[model samples]
Target: MAEKEKQEDYRVEIGGDDSKRSYTPAPAPSVSNSPTMAILSYCGASILMTLTNKYVLSGYDFNLNFMLLAIQNIICVVAIQGAKSMGSISYRDFKMDEARKWFPISLLLISMIYTGSKAIQYLSVPVYTIFKNLTIILIAYGEVLWFGGSVSRLTLFSFGLMVLSSVVAAWADINAAISSYGHDASETATALSTLNAGYIWMLVNCLSSAAYVLGMRKRIKLTNFKDFDTMFYNNLLSIPVILLCSLFLEDWSSANIDRNFPSAQRNNLIIAIIFSGLSSVFISYTSAWCVRVASSTTYSMVGALNKLPIALSGLIFFDAPVTFPSVSAIAIGFVSGLVYAMAKVKQQKVATTSLPVSSASSASMRDGLKN
Candidate 1:
């Protein structure tokens, strides 16, 4: 009996030991995966926006364009707040007071309006996308000059390549636009004038976009506001600015809703508006989600990737040209932008790891030394 009791006790101890050994802590959840999803959502939104521009705004005057964009931004504000509520996040935690430093936000609104209007006027969707990416190069140079940061020779070479590629793409777009108007004797003069105007507007758009990017980076870092909160504040601030711009700059007299479209096209326009609203919400939410998961540089690269699909879709939908040189330019620009992004990410990771060890680690090391 004594032997049996000892054996049972030993078995219980072994079983308990086995149970403890089998136990494993759960893995840390990955935040990086969310960025990939966010990127897809953003790309999807761009495609929807392209479709809206092509079909809905076909014969409408410029006033409608401004109004539609304002409406989209308004929808974005509401959607972002909805997303925050659903996610159980509080804007109060992000410190709204910091947004009072408004220069960057105002610049961003200006950039958006300038870029949107100019791209629609002068360049095809694909061409605008290729050149708009210059903002990234601008930001890099801005940092080197404004912040006294060191830039590698490779980065400069990459920028040069992108510039050369943009020239090639622009040449192709100009040729395509000219050829399309060749059959229309009456419209040729108008097309030429529009092209010149587009070029000028796009230049301003690029400069404003660059300034906005650099300023936002500096301001966000200084304020240390959460990404969601920054987005919310930016969208909110942009609403009033855009509204004012539209009210003054747009020609309301030309906005004849019924006359602009045929009976058959009216339904299509409504459908486009619905889709635009949905896409705006998706874009605002996913972009904020992406910033939370990945660094801003990564988000920017993903944004560049969105241009490819937009370009391709524009070609198919709007009968935009797809010349060899233009395609090559886009390919080179995208590759270089991606390379720069990867380099930035690597540098960021290195900087993060190189930070000093926590106080706990230092204390533990001292305790060991004393022991």
Candidate 2:
């Protein structure tokens, strides 16, 4: 405990106080605050979100991603407030200053969701999931830039594998795009167009996601905000931004109200929407909870490990083609992600080990000077 305090003091001195932030590491996981439950909730919510979006966008032709996200944000705000009212969780009262500090991160969050939904609308879930690995690469680079850390040789090697795997997956997508070559010229043209647009949106989503995660890290550290506080601020503040974007960007005239959202189909749509919103809530809460209980590296590893299952589920549920190239690309992506996760875990362990030694050395020097 003394050593831990010394290390904490050393870290604060080196890292500088984050605006006189009242820093508090979240409590360790117990039966009441279970890591396993958090992980399960995160995984389930993520999978449901992916599957639900695919069904709505691809199956029902409901292409208003911005509008959908706005609705989801609204739902999040209402549900969180309801929970607070019931005393399920506690958060500090919202202040204008804190909202202003949180707005930039909210913008990044909006971009990430908007672009990701657009990509999912165009790309099959499997292809989209594989390509989404690119976000890991971007986040790794962001950490290096923001935190002033050096990447290890092994970590660099893992990054190389990830890059190679992403390239191969992209190649497979291109090949799939043109595979309808002889069947229907018009269909081939459509597939090619969607593939092109999907790749662009996917890349945009990766960049935005990386930025959001990094910004969220800064906000949490600097403001000393807890998970529920972060969720409340992000969703509540994003509602208006999302609404404005929807008004300009979405084609309200093109929305087939009767066909896409008929009264008879309202049940399915309602279920999908409600579940989608709730799942998003689950994701946000669980992700933050998991990171608090476990380490950030563990949170990252859970995400990396889930990719393969998600990819496989997509294949099983969707009508996508299964060829040697596609299979190989998926395998490569899964393997590369695993390697990246391992490299990251090792890197974090090294950092942890070095912290105690550095703190001890500093303590020794202080003692010697006093003597």
Candidate 3:
């Protein structure tokens, strides 16, 4: 899977435009547009996006996460509209039927982004990033339950490691907090409570994200929307929903621009949101380009490999505490992601080989002879 949250954020390059058609992997691009270059662009943009959002939510104390997301979505919608006007992209007009069909899945997406933001607000970047690994497992199991796919032994082993690492990481985080802040009973209690809340929200984030991914798999088929179309509809439809959520769920008095604008960091918050929006645009383009230039297999590997750099950057950039178990847990999670990536490659290869192309052709020829 791609490292990014939104599935429709990428433009998948395919041979034709049959909405319900199956996909065949395209050949890799040439040296000038190499997989390495694509992967680097994608990884860089994604890392920047993640760090920027974390800074906005945590460092800038712009805790109105839903509103921030709404702003981002608005930016995306404008960009898409402009691109359409400029002939840079093509998309279908919005339809009420499709909008109605997409409403429930959009709710799942909103939940995913909201809980993910809350998780980042409460947890360190490294912890939050590592916990995101659980999404892979959640989506995998969700496929097994909802799509009739069976889990293999390797997948089982990898997911088991991820689960174990999550437990160890949580324990390490709690202990490290106690060691650092144990002198003040009240502070220690607050730290413990925050950690607990962060983990709970992280779990919710994983489940909701998993649900969104799985639901989109079916929803996309029904809608027959390609990448740009999907992005347009998903973001456009989400604006109103996100606004309602921010209004009801958020404390607008504190998050209001009139109140926070007087603060010294107002300029900083503006800069952060601008950068966040630009980086999001960068990510959408680079990630899709990566998938187009590289194979999906290489894209998956890049996503797996990028986790280490993101984990390290979190610890270096932020003041997240370092501990043996926490470090070890990240390492284990990294390896598990690699395992999952390898498993995916093997499965794709198997699926390709298992296609009965020759038999289908032969049957067609026999029918032609009869005709």
Per residue, candidate 2 scores C-alpha lDDT tens digits across 296-364 of 666766777777877777888887767777788788878877786787677667767876332221111
List of clashing residue pairs for candidate 2: none
The per-candidate count of clashes, in order, stands at 1, 0, 0
Instruction: Show model 2 residue runs off by greater than 4 Å.
Output: 1-33, 262-264, 356-371
RMSD after CA superposition, every candidate: 9.5, 11.8, 12.2
Q: Pick the candidate with the highest TM-score.
A: 3
Give the C-alpha miss distance for residue 168 in model 2, angstroms. Answer: 2.3
Worst 10 residues of 2 by lDDT: 362-371
lDDT order of candidates, top first: 3, 2, 1
Q: What tens-digit string does per-residue lDDT give for candidate 1 at 238-264?
A: 777777877887655634655554476
Runs off by more than 4 Å, candidate 1: 1-35, 54-62, 85-88, 93-99, 182-186, 259-263, 294-300, 345-371
Model 1: lDDT equals: 0.62
CA lDDT of every candidate: 0.62, 0.74, 0.74
Better of 2 and 3 by TM-score: 3
Candidate 1 global Cα RMSD: 9.5
Model 1: residue 144 alpha-carbon error in angstroms: 1.4
- TM-score, model 3 to reference: 0.83
